[model samples]
Target: MRPKEFVYHRARDLDHALALLAEHGEEARPISGGQSLVPMMNLRLARPDHLVDVNDLGLDEIREEAGALHVGAMVRHERYLTDPLIRRHLPALLEAVHWIGHPTIRRNGTLGGSLCHADPTAELPAMAVLHGARIVLASTAGRREVAACDFFKGAYMTDVQPGEMLVSVIFPCPQGAHSGAFEELGERLGDFAMGSFGVVLEHEGGVIRRAATVCGGAKMTPIRLPEIEAALQGQTLAGLDAAALGDRVTGLIAPAGDFQVSAEYRRALIGELAGRALQRARDIALNAQP
Candidate 1:
Protein backbone atom coordinates (compact mmCIF):
# COMPACT_ATOMS: atom_id res chain seq x y z
CA MET A 1 0.00 0.00 0.00
CA ARG A 2 1.08 3.57 -0.62
CA PRO A 3 1.79 5.93 2.23
CA LYS A 4 -1.01 8.13 3.52
CA GLU A 5 -1.43 11.56 1.99
CA PHE A 6 1.10 13.96 3.54
CA VAL A 7 2.51 17.44 2.93
CA TYR A 8 6.10 17.37 1.69
CA HIS A 9 8.45 20.19 2.70
CA ARG A 10 11.95 20.22 1.30
CA ALA A 11 14.20 21.88 3.85
CA ARG A 12 16.70 24.40 2.47
CA ASP A 13 19.05 24.31 5.43
CA LEU A 14 19.63 22.89 8.91
CA ASP A 15 17.74 25.68 10.63
CA HIS A 16 14.96 25.32 8.11
CA ALA A 17 14.67 21.63 8.85
CA LEU A 18 14.52 22.24 12.57
CA ALA A 19 11.88 24.93 12.08
CA LEU A 20 9.78 22.61 9.93
CA LEU A 21 10.07 19.89 12.53
CA ALA A 22 9.17 22.31 15.31
CA GLU A 23 6.19 23.58 13.37
CA HIS A 24 4.80 20.15 12.60
CA GLY A 25 5.93 18.64 15.93
CA GLU A 26 5.11 14.92 16.14
CA GLU A 27 3.11 15.09 12.95
CA ALA A 28 6.27 15.73 10.92
CA ARG A 29 8.92 13.17 9.95
CA PRO A 30 12.38 14.28 8.82
CA ILE A 31 13.55 12.15 5.93
CA SER A 32 16.99 11.85 4.39
CA GLY A 33 17.92 8.53 2.73
CA GLY A 34 14.45 7.14 3.39
CA GLN A 35 15.77 3.58 3.10
CA SER A 36 14.07 2.58 6.33
CA LEU A 37 11.27 5.13 6.73
CA VAL A 38 9.87 4.87 3.23
CA PRO A 39 9.34 1.14 3.61
CA MET A 40 7.59 1.68 6.92
CA MET A 41 5.43 4.37 5.36
CA ASN A 42 4.63 2.13 2.39
CA LEU A 43 3.34 -0.48 4.82
CA ARG A 44 1.35 2.15 6.76
CA LEU A 45 3.47 1.47 9.82
CA ALA A 46 4.14 5.23 10.01
CA ARG A 47 1.63 7.91 9.02
CA PRO A 48 3.13 11.31 9.69
CA ASP A 49 1.03 14.17 8.34
CA HIS A 50 4.10 16.06 7.12
CA LEU A 51 7.36 14.96 5.52
CA VAL A 52 10.35 17.24 6.10
CA ASP A 53 13.02 16.46 3.53
CA VAL A 54 16.51 16.97 4.97
CA ASN A 55 18.62 15.67 2.07
CA ASP A 56 19.77 19.16 1.12
CA LEU A 57 20.61 20.33 4.64
CA GLY A 58 24.35 19.62 4.07
CA LEU A 59 24.78 17.07 6.86
CA ASP A 60 27.04 14.69 4.86
CA GLU A 61 30.63 15.35 5.81
CA ILE A 62 33.10 13.19 7.73
CA ARG A 63 35.92 14.81 9.66
CA GLU A 64 38.21 14.48 12.62
CA GLU A 65 37.37 16.87 15.46
CA ALA A 66 39.47 17.29 18.58
CA GLY A 67 40.33 13.67 19.44
CA ALA A 68 37.26 12.07 17.87
CA LEU A 69 35.76 11.46 14.48
CA HIS A 70 32.73 13.63 13.71
CA VAL A 71 30.47 11.96 11.17
CA GLY A 72 27.58 13.95 9.81
CA ALA A 73 24.21 12.28 10.19
CA MET A 74 23.50 12.22 6.46
CA VAL A 75 26.76 10.53 5.53
CA ARG A 76 25.90 7.46 3.47
CA HIS A 77 26.92 3.92 4.27
CA GLU A 78 29.07 3.85 1.12
CA ARG A 79 31.36 6.46 2.64
CA TYR A 80 32.27 4.18 5.54
CA LEU A 81 33.93 1.78 3.12
CA THR A 82 36.22 4.46 1.65
CA ASP A 83 36.64 7.26 4.20
CA PRO A 84 40.20 7.43 5.52
CA LEU A 85 39.10 8.67 8.94
CA ILE A 86 36.65 5.78 9.27
CA ARG A 87 39.29 3.34 8.08
CA ARG A 88 41.81 4.53 10.66
CA HIS A 89 39.59 5.01 13.68
CA LEU A 90 36.54 2.80 13.20
CA PRO A 91 37.60 -0.15 11.10
CA ALA A 92 35.09 -2.40 12.79
CA LEU A 93 32.31 -0.15 11.51
CA LEU A 94 33.79 -0.46 8.05
CA GLU A 95 33.77 -4.22 8.38
CA ALA A 96 30.20 -4.26 9.61
CA VAL A 97 29.05 -1.97 6.84
CA HIS A 98 29.87 -4.70 4.38
CA TRP A 99 27.10 -6.82 5.89
CA ILE A 100 24.38 -4.20 5.38
CA GLY A 101 21.72 -5.01 2.76
CA HIS A 102 23.11 -4.68 -0.78
CA PRO A 103 24.96 -2.22 -3.02
CA THR A 104 21.85 -0.12 -3.55
CA ILE A 105 21.04 0.06 0.14
CA ARG A 106 24.61 0.95 1.04
CA ARG A 107 24.68 3.69 -1.56
CA ASN A 108 21.59 5.42 -0.14
CA GLY A 109 21.28 4.45 3.52
CA THR A 110 22.40 7.27 5.83
CA LEU A 111 24.13 6.64 9.14
CA GLY A 112 21.68 8.79 11.08
CA GLY A 113 18.67 7.13 9.49
CA SER A 114 19.89 3.65 10.41
CA LEU A 115 20.65 4.65 14.00
CA CYS A 116 17.33 6.43 14.39
CA HIS A 117 15.49 3.51 12.82
CA ALA A 118 17.13 1.41 15.54
CA ASP A 119 16.70 -2.10 14.16
CA PRO A 120 17.89 -4.54 16.81
CA THR A 121 19.78 -6.55 14.17
CA ALA A 122 21.38 -3.59 12.38
CA GLU A 123 25.18 -3.47 12.14
CA LEU A 124 25.53 0.30 12.53
CA PRO A 125 23.92 0.52 15.96
CA ALA A 126 26.04 -2.35 17.23
CA MET A 127 29.15 -0.59 15.93
CA ALA A 128 28.16 2.66 17.64
CA VAL A 129 27.80 0.86 20.96
CA LEU A 130 31.12 -0.91 20.49
CA HIS A 131 32.85 2.38 19.73
CA GLY A 132 31.19 4.24 22.59
CA ALA A 133 30.06 6.94 20.19
CA ARG A 134 28.01 10.00 21.13
CA ILE A 135 24.83 10.81 19.19
CA VAL A 136 24.07 14.51 18.70
CA LEU A 137 20.43 15.53 18.49
CA ALA A 138 19.36 19.03 17.50
CA SER A 139 16.19 21.08 17.69
CA THR A 140 15.01 24.71 17.97
CA ALA A 141 15.56 24.50 21.73
CA GLY A 142 19.23 23.53 21.30
CA ARG A 143 21.26 20.36 21.06
CA ARG A 144 22.14 17.53 23.40
CA GLU A 145 24.52 14.59 23.12
CA VAL A 146 23.47 11.13 24.19
CA ALA A 147 25.64 8.10 24.65
CA ALA A 148 25.12 5.54 21.91
CA CYS A 149 24.25 2.84 24.43
CA ASP A 150 21.53 5.03 25.96
CA PHE A 151 20.29 6.60 22.74
CA PHE A 152 18.63 3.39 21.58
CA LYS A 153 15.58 2.77 23.75
CA GLY A 154 14.39 -0.32 21.83
CA ALA A 155 13.75 -1.73 18.39
CA TYR A 156 12.46 1.04 16.12
CA MET A 157 12.78 3.55 19.00
CA THR A 158 15.38 6.06 20.13
CA ASP A 159 15.86 9.04 22.42
CA VAL A 160 15.17 11.48 19.57
CA GLN A 161 12.12 13.53 20.47
CA PRO A 162 9.44 14.60 18.03
CA GLY A 163 10.97 18.00 17.21
CA GLU A 164 14.62 16.99 17.14
CA MET A 165 16.87 15.67 14.37
CA LEU A 166 20.06 13.76 14.70
CA VAL A 167 22.93 16.02 13.58
CA SER A 168 26.01 13.82 13.81
CA VAL A 169 27.82 11.11 15.73
CA ILE A 170 31.13 11.53 17.59
CA PHE A 171 33.48 8.58 18.03
CA PRO A 172 36.59 8.90 20.19
CA CYS A 173 39.83 8.00 18.46
CA PRO A 174 41.67 4.97 19.72
CA GLN A 175 44.55 6.08 21.96
CA GLY A 176 46.89 3.20 21.22
CA ALA A 177 47.33 0.29 18.87
CA HIS A 178 44.00 -1.37 18.32
CA SER A 179 42.19 -3.86 16.10
CA GLY A 180 38.60 -4.83 15.58
CA ALA A 181 36.61 -7.61 13.92
CA PHE A 182 32.95 -8.19 13.00
CA GLU A 183 31.31 -11.55 12.48
CA GLU A 184 27.74 -12.62 11.83
CA LEU A 185 25.58 -15.51 10.68
CA GLY A 186 22.63 -14.93 8.36
CA GLU A 187 20.37 -17.09 6.22
CA ARG A 188 21.59 -15.34 3.10
CA LEU A 189 24.43 -12.97 2.14
CA GLY A 190 22.45 -9.78 2.62
CA ASP A 191 19.75 -11.08 4.93
CA PHE A 192 19.16 -9.81 8.44
CA ALA A 193 21.57 -11.57 10.76
CA MET A 194 20.58 -14.50 12.93
CA GLY A 195 23.33 -13.31 15.24
CA SER A 196 26.21 -10.84 14.95
CA PHE A 197 29.16 -9.85 17.12
CA GLY A 198 31.77 -7.10 17.08
CA VAL A 199 34.95 -6.91 19.12
CA VAL A 200 37.54 -4.15 19.52
CA LEU A 201 40.81 -4.83 21.26
CA GLU A 202 43.38 -2.28 22.36
CA HIS A 203 46.51 -4.18 23.19
CA GLU A 204 50.10 -3.66 24.29
CA GLY A 205 52.87 -6.23 24.65
CA GLY A 206 50.46 -8.99 23.60
CA VAL A 207 48.17 -8.25 26.56
CA ILE A 208 44.75 -6.68 26.39
CA ARG A 209 44.70 -3.11 27.75
CA ARG A 210 41.14 -2.38 26.76
CA ALA A 211 38.34 -4.29 25.15
CA ALA A 212 34.86 -3.56 23.87
CA THR A 213 32.27 -6.08 22.69
CA VAL A 214 28.72 -5.84 21.37
CA CYS A 215 26.11 -8.27 20.09
CA GLY A 216 23.23 -7.71 17.66
CA GLY A 217 20.17 -9.66 16.41
CA ALA A 218 19.82 -11.25 19.81
CA LYS A 219 18.26 -8.62 22.05
CA MET A 220 15.97 -5.60 22.14
CA THR A 221 18.92 -3.35 21.28
CA PRO A 222 22.59 -3.81 20.68
CA ILE A 223 23.94 -5.26 23.90
CA ARG A 224 27.38 -4.17 25.11
CA LEU A 225 29.26 -6.68 27.22
CA PRO A 226 31.03 -4.72 29.94
CA GLU A 227 31.53 -7.74 32.12
CA ILE A 228 33.15 -9.67 29.29
CA GLU A 229 35.33 -6.68 28.47
CA ALA A 230 36.42 -6.41 32.09
CA ALA A 231 37.24 -10.10 32.13
CA LEU A 232 39.48 -9.63 29.07
CA GLN A 233 41.58 -6.91 30.67
CA GLY A 234 45.21 -7.90 31.19
CA GLN A 235 44.55 -11.25 29.52
CA THR A 236 47.48 -12.32 27.38
CA LEU A 237 46.71 -13.10 23.77
CA ALA A 238 48.76 -16.25 23.82
CA GLY A 239 46.56 -17.80 26.52
CA LEU A 240 43.15 -16.38 25.61
CA ASP A 241 40.45 -19.05 25.41
CA ALA A 242 37.90 -18.11 22.76
CA ALA A 243 35.59 -21.02 23.48
CA ALA A 244 35.53 -20.28 27.19
CA LEU A 245 34.63 -16.66 26.50
CA GLY A 246 31.91 -17.86 24.13
CA ASP A 247 30.50 -20.05 26.86
CA ARG A 248 30.46 -17.11 29.23
CA VAL A 249 28.54 -15.03 26.66
CA THR A 250 26.05 -17.86 26.17
CA GLY A 251 25.36 -17.81 29.88
CA LEU A 252 25.02 -14.02 30.06
CA ILE A 253 22.60 -13.27 27.21
CA ALA A 254 19.01 -14.57 26.95
CA PRO A 255 17.88 -14.21 23.35
CA ALA A 256 14.17 -14.69 22.63
CA GLY A 257 13.06 -17.32 20.13
CA ASP A 258 11.32 -16.41 16.92
CA PHE A 259 9.89 -18.05 13.76
CA GLN A 260 13.34 -18.30 12.17
CA VAL A 261 15.11 -19.98 15.07
CA SER A 262 14.68 -21.14 18.62
CA ALA A 263 16.00 -19.11 21.54
CA GLU A 264 18.58 -21.78 22.35
CA TYR A 265 19.78 -21.82 18.73
CA ARG A 266 20.13 -18.04 18.64
CA ARG A 267 21.97 -18.05 21.95
CA ALA A 268 24.44 -20.62 20.67
CA LEU A 269 24.85 -18.83 17.35
CA ILE A 270 25.59 -15.54 19.12
CA GLY A 271 28.06 -17.26 21.39
CA GLU A 272 29.88 -18.80 18.46
CA LEU A 273 29.90 -15.51 16.60
CA ALA A 274 31.28 -13.76 19.68
CA GLY A 275 34.10 -16.23 19.96
CA ARG A 276 34.99 -15.91 16.29
CA ALA A 277 34.93 -12.11 16.47
CA LEU A 278 37.11 -12.10 19.56
CA GLN A 279 39.60 -14.51 18.08
CA ARG A 280 39.80 -12.56 14.84
CA ALA A 281 40.28 -9.29 16.73
CA ARG A 282 43.09 -10.79 18.79
CA ASP A 283 44.81 -12.09 15.66
CA ILE A 284 44.64 -8.69 14.03
CA ALA A 285 46.07 -6.97 17.12
CA LEU A 286 48.91 -9.48 17.27
CA ASN A 287 49.72 -9.01 13.60
CA ALA A 288 49.93 -5.24 14.09
CA GLN A 289 52.51 -5.52 16.85
CA PRO A 290 56.03 -4.38 15.99
Candidate 2:
Protein backbone atom coordinates (compact mmCIF):
# COMPACT_ATOMS: atom_id res chain seq x y z
CA MET A 1 0.00 0.00 0.00
CA ARG A 2 1.12 3.51 -0.71
CA PRO A 3 1.33 6.22 1.94
CA LYS A 4 -1.53 8.69 2.10
CA GLU A 5 -1.30 12.05 0.35
CA PHE A 6 1.09 14.44 2.11
CA VAL A 7 2.68 17.83 1.61
CA TYR A 8 6.44 17.73 1.02
CA HIS A 9 8.80 20.35 2.44
CA ARG A 10 12.51 20.25 1.75
CA ALA A 11 14.42 21.69 4.67
CA ARG A 12 17.68 23.48 3.90
CA ASP A 13 19.09 23.67 7.42
CA LEU A 14 18.52 22.83 11.08
CA ASP A 15 16.44 25.94 11.54
CA HIS A 16 14.32 25.10 8.52
CA ALA A 17 13.66 21.57 9.73
CA LEU A 18 12.73 22.75 13.20
CA ALA A 19 10.44 25.39 11.76
CA LEU A 20 8.72 22.86 9.54
CA LEU A 21 8.27 20.49 12.48
CA ALA A 22 7.01 23.27 14.69
CA GLU A 23 4.56 24.44 12.07
CA HIS A 24 3.17 20.99 11.43
CA GLY A 25 3.46 19.48 14.90
CA GLU A 26 2.56 15.77 15.08
CA GLU A 27 1.27 15.94 11.51
CA ALA A 28 4.81 16.30 10.20
CA ARG A 29 7.36 13.46 9.87
CA PRO A 30 11.05 13.91 9.10
CA ILE A 31 12.80 11.75 6.54
CA SER A 32 16.52 11.20 6.20
CA GLY A 33 17.63 7.81 4.82
CA GLY A 34 13.99 6.57 4.96
CA GLN A 35 15.01 3.04 5.83
CA SER A 36 12.57 2.69 8.73
CA LEU A 37 9.93 5.35 8.22
CA VAL A 38 9.38 4.67 4.54
CA PRO A 39 8.57 1.06 5.19
CA MET A 40 6.21 2.01 7.97
CA MET A 41 4.51 4.42 5.62
CA ASN A 42 4.27 1.83 2.87
CA LEU A 43 2.52 -0.50 5.27
CA ARG A 44 0.14 2.26 6.36
CA LEU A 45 1.57 2.03 9.87
CA ALA A 46 2.33 5.77 9.76
CA ARG A 47 0.52 8.41 7.76
CA PRO A 48 1.82 11.84 8.59
CA ASP A 49 0.19 14.67 6.67
CA HIS A 50 3.52 16.36 5.97
CA LEU A 51 6.94 15.03 4.98
CA VAL A 52 9.78 17.26 6.19
CA ASP A 53 12.83 16.20 4.21
CA VAL A 54 15.89 16.78 6.41
CA ASN A 55 18.70 15.41 4.25
CA ASP A 56 20.18 18.87 3.69
CA LEU A 57 20.26 19.81 7.35
CA GLY A 58 24.04 19.14 7.58
CA LEU A 59 23.48 16.82 10.53
CA ASP A 60 25.69 14.14 9.06
CA GLU A 61 29.14 14.89 10.42
CA ILE A 62 31.15 13.05 13.06
CA ARG A 63 33.36 15.17 15.25
CA GLU A 64 34.76 15.51 18.76
CA GLU A 65 33.50 17.91 21.38
CA ALA A 66 34.70 18.50 24.93
CA GLY A 67 36.58 15.18 24.74
CA ALA A 68 33.51 13.21 23.63
CA LEU A 69 32.34 12.04 20.22
CA HIS A 70 29.40 14.03 18.81
CA VAL A 71 27.72 11.87 16.20
CA GLY A 72 25.31 13.78 14.02
CA ALA A 73 21.74 12.59 13.68
CA MET A 74 22.13 11.80 9.98
CA VAL A 75 25.32 9.76 10.35
CA ARG A 76 24.50 6.51 8.63
CA HIS A 77 25.44 3.09 9.97
CA GLU A 78 28.14 2.64 7.31
CA ARG A 79 29.58 6.04 8.24
CA TYR A 80 30.20 4.92 11.81
CA LEU A 81 31.58 1.58 10.59
CA THR A 82 34.10 3.35 8.35
CA ASP A 83 34.87 6.54 10.29
CA PRO A 84 38.21 6.31 12.11
CA LEU A 85 36.91 8.52 14.90
CA ILE A 86 33.99 6.24 15.66
CA ARG A 87 36.11 3.13 15.33
CA ARG A 88 38.69 4.56 17.73
CA HIS A 89 36.49 6.16 20.36
CA LEU A 90 33.46 3.88 20.25
CA PRO A 91 34.50 0.34 19.44
CA ALA A 92 31.29 -1.04 20.87
CA LEU A 93 29.41 0.94 18.20
CA LEU A 94 31.60 -0.59 15.49
CA GLU A 95 30.99 -4.10 16.85
CA ALA A 96 27.23 -3.62 16.77
CA VAL A 97 26.83 -1.54 13.59
CA HIS A 98 27.98 -4.36 11.35
CA TRP A 99 25.20 -6.52 12.72
CA ILE A 100 22.43 -4.09 11.74
CA GLY A 101 20.67 -5.21 8.54
CA HIS A 102 23.09 -5.51 5.57
CA PRO A 103 25.50 -3.31 3.66
CA THR A 104 22.75 -1.58 1.67
CA ILE A 105 20.69 -0.99 4.79
CA ARG A 106 23.70 0.25 6.74
CA ARG A 107 24.57 2.57 3.88
CA ASN A 108 21.27 4.39 4.34
CA GLY A 109 20.17 3.79 7.95
CA THR A 110 20.92 6.88 10.03
CA LEU A 111 22.04 6.75 13.68
CA GLY A 112 19.53 9.39 14.74
CA GLY A 113 16.92 7.63 12.67
CA SER A 114 17.59 4.36 14.45
CA LEU A 115 17.52 5.91 17.92
CA CYS A 116 14.30 7.71 17.13
CA HIS A 117 12.87 4.57 15.56
CA ALA A 118 13.37 2.98 19.00
CA ASP A 119 13.33 -0.65 17.93
CA PRO A 120 13.71 -2.77 21.04
CA THR A 121 16.62 -4.82 19.72
CA ALA A 122 18.34 -2.32 17.40
CA GLU A 123 22.11 -2.25 17.84
CA LEU A 124 22.69 1.49 18.30
CA PRO A 125 20.25 2.11 21.13
CA ALA A 126 21.32 -1.04 22.98
CA MET A 127 25.01 -0.21 22.66
CA ALA A 128 24.37 3.42 23.53
CA VAL A 129 22.77 2.46 26.83
CA LEU A 130 25.62 0.04 27.51
CA HIS A 131 28.17 2.82 27.00
CA GLY A 132 26.20 5.39 28.99
CA ALA A 133 25.65 7.51 25.89
CA ARG A 134 23.50 10.65 25.79
CA ILE A 135 21.00 11.67 23.12
CA VAL A 136 20.40 15.30 22.18
CA LEU A 137 16.93 16.37 21.05
CA ALA A 138 16.26 19.70 19.35
CA SER A 139 13.24 21.82 18.54
CA THR A 140 12.46 25.46 17.80
CA ALA A 141 12.32 26.22 21.51
CA GLY A 142 15.70 24.77 22.43
CA ARG A 143 17.47 21.46 23.03
CA ARG A 144 17.81 18.97 25.85
CA GLU A 145 20.06 16.01 26.61
CA VAL A 146 18.77 12.68 27.80
CA ALA A 147 20.47 9.51 28.94
CA ALA A 148 20.26 6.82 26.30
CA CYS A 149 18.75 4.43 28.81
CA ASP A 150 15.99 6.93 29.52
CA PHE A 151 15.38 7.90 25.92
CA PHE A 152 13.02 5.08 25.09
CA LYS A 153 9.57 4.84 26.60
CA GLY A 154 8.73 1.53 24.85
CA ALA A 155 8.90 -0.20 21.48
CA TYR A 156 9.04 2.34 18.65
CA MET A 157 8.48 5.14 21.18
CA THR A 158 10.88 7.75 22.60
CA ASP A 159 11.08 11.01 24.51
CA VAL A 160 11.37 12.88 21.21
CA GLN A 161 8.82 15.65 21.54
CA PRO A 162 6.49 16.13 18.57
CA GLY A 163 8.22 19.21 17.23
CA GLU A 164 11.70 18.06 18.18
CA MET A 165 14.22 16.12 16.10
CA LEU A 166 17.15 14.13 17.29
CA VAL A 167 20.15 16.34 16.51
CA SER A 168 23.07 14.18 17.71
CA VAL A 169 24.26 11.47 20.03
CA ILE A 170 27.07 12.16 22.49
CA PHE A 171 29.27 9.28 23.63
CA PRO A 172 31.72 9.85 26.45
CA CYS A 173 35.26 8.93 25.56
CA PRO A 174 36.24 5.85 27.50
CA GLN A 175 38.52 6.85 30.35
CA GLY A 176 40.65 4.90 32.75
CA ALA A 177 40.69 1.09 32.53
CA HIS A 178 37.59 0.25 30.53
CA SER A 179 36.45 -2.07 27.77
CA GLY A 180 33.16 -2.93 26.10
CA ALA A 181 31.79 -5.75 23.93
CA PHE A 182 28.49 -6.54 22.20
CA GLU A 183 27.02 -9.93 21.33
CA GLU A 184 23.66 -11.26 20.14
CA LEU A 185 21.88 -14.50 19.23
CA GLY A 186 20.13 -14.28 15.89
CA GLU A 187 18.78 -16.83 13.42
CA ARG A 188 20.87 -15.40 10.62
CA LEU A 189 23.41 -12.67 10.01
CA GLY A 190 20.89 -9.90 9.27
CA ASP A 191 17.96 -11.14 11.30
CA PHE A 192 16.71 -9.43 14.42
CA ALA A 193 18.52 -10.86 17.42
CA MET A 194 16.58 -13.32 19.50
CA GLY A 195 18.61 -11.98 22.38
CA SER A 196 21.35 -9.35 22.54
CA PHE A 197 23.74 -8.03 25.17
CA GLY A 198 26.28 -5.20 25.45
CA VAL A 199 28.66 -4.66 28.33
CA VAL A 200 31.23 -2.17 29.58
CA LEU A 201 33.65 -3.15 32.29
CA GLU A 202 36.08 -1.08 34.31
CA HIS A 203 38.78 -2.73 36.33
CA GLU A 204 41.19 -1.62 39.02
CA GLY A 205 43.71 -3.71 40.92
CA GLY A 206 42.53 -6.72 38.84
CA VAL A 207 39.01 -6.29 40.20
CA ILE A 208 35.90 -4.94 38.53
CA ARG A 209 35.37 -1.34 39.66
CA ARG A 210 32.38 -0.46 37.48
CA ALA A 211 30.09 -2.32 35.08
CA ALA A 212 27.44 -1.26 32.56
CA THR A 213 25.48 -4.18 31.17
CA VAL A 214 22.39 -4.05 28.90
CA CYS A 215 20.23 -6.62 27.13
CA GLY A 216 18.07 -6.15 24.03
CA GLY A 217 15.42 -7.77 21.71
CA ALA A 218 13.90 -9.63 24.62
CA LYS A 219 12.05 -6.64 26.00
CA MET A 220 10.25 -3.43 25.01
CA THR A 221 13.41 -1.49 25.89
CA PRO A 222 17.04 -2.36 26.52
CA ILE A 223 17.21 -3.77 30.03
CA ARG A 224 20.26 -2.55 31.92
CA LEU A 225 21.39 -5.09 34.47
CA PRO A 226 22.28 -2.74 37.30
CA GLU A 227 21.50 -5.29 40.00
CA ILE A 228 23.73 -7.81 38.28
CA GLU A 229 26.28 -5.11 37.61
CA ALA A 230 26.24 -4.24 41.30
CA ALA A 231 26.65 -7.89 42.10
CA LEU A 232 29.66 -8.19 39.82
CA GLN A 233 31.38 -5.06 41.14
CA GLY A 234 34.81 -5.83 42.62
CA GLN A 235 34.69 -9.41 41.26
CA THR A 236 37.79 -10.61 39.46
CA LEU A 237 37.21 -11.49 35.81
CA ALA A 238 38.91 -14.85 36.08
CA GLY A 239 36.87 -15.73 39.13
CA LEU A 240 33.70 -14.60 37.32
CA ASP A 241 31.68 -17.60 36.25
CA ALA A 242 29.49 -17.19 33.17
CA ALA A 243 26.90 -19.63 34.42
CA ALA A 244 26.55 -17.71 37.66
CA LEU A 245 25.89 -14.42 35.89
CA GLY A 246 23.62 -16.14 33.39
CA ASP A 247 21.56 -17.70 36.15
CA ARG A 248 21.31 -14.46 38.06
CA VAL A 249 20.01 -12.53 34.99
CA THR A 250 17.61 -15.27 34.01
CA GLY A 251 15.89 -14.84 37.33
CA LEU A 252 15.83 -11.05 37.26
CA ILE A 253 14.36 -10.39 33.80
CA ALA A 254 10.98 -11.57 32.55
CA PRO A 255 10.91 -10.90 28.82
CA ALA A 256 7.63 -11.41 27.01
CA GLY A 257 7.69 -13.78 24.06
CA ASP A 258 6.74 -12.90 20.51
CA PHE A 259 5.57 -15.21 17.74
CA GLN A 260 9.10 -15.99 16.62
CA VAL A 261 10.48 -16.80 20.08
CA SER A 262 9.05 -18.00 23.36
CA ALA A 263 9.53 -16.09 26.61
CA GLU A 264 11.21 -19.10 28.19
CA TYR A 265 13.52 -19.53 25.20
CA ARG A 266 14.23 -15.80 25.01
CA ARG A 267 15.16 -15.76 28.68
CA ALA A 268 17.54 -18.66 28.13
CA LEU A 269 19.23 -16.87 25.23
CA ILE A 270 19.49 -13.62 27.17
CA GLY A 271 21.16 -15.47 30.02
CA GLU A 272 23.64 -17.10 27.69
CA LEU A 273 24.43 -13.91 25.72
CA ALA A 274 24.87 -12.01 28.98
CA GLY A 275 27.70 -14.36 29.95
CA ARG A 276 29.27 -14.14 26.50
CA ALA A 277 29.20 -10.35 26.41
CA LEU A 278 30.56 -10.08 29.95
CA GLN A 279 33.37 -12.51 29.19
CA ARG A 280 34.43 -10.59 26.09
CA ALA A 281 34.23 -7.31 27.98
CA ARG A 282 36.37 -8.83 30.72
CA ASP A 283 39.01 -9.95 28.24
CA ILE A 284 39.20 -6.47 26.76
CA ALA A 285 39.27 -4.81 30.16
CA LEU A 286 42.08 -7.10 31.23
CA ASN A 287 44.25 -6.71 28.13
CA ALA A 288 43.16 -3.62 26.14
CA GLN A 289 43.70 -1.04 28.84
CA PRO A 290 44.42 2.38 27.42
Predicted model with the maximum TM-score: 1
lDDT of each residue in 107-209, candidate 2, tens digit only: 9889888898888988888977877889999999999999998998999999998899999989887766667788887889988878898777777777888
What TM-score, over all chains together, does every model reach?
Answer: 0.98, 0.95
Model 1 over residues 148-239: C-alpha lDDT tens digits?
A: 99999998999999899999999887768889899988899888888999988888889999999999976989999988999998999878
Candidate 2: regions farther than 4 A off:
none
Candidate maximizing lDDT: 1
TM-score, predicted candidate 2 vs. hidden true structure: 0.95
Q: On a 0 to 1 TM-score scale, where does candidate 1 land against the true structure?
A: 0.98
For candidate 2, what's the RMSD? Answer: 1.6
For candidate 2, the clash count comes to: 0
Output the lDDT of residue 74, model 2.
93
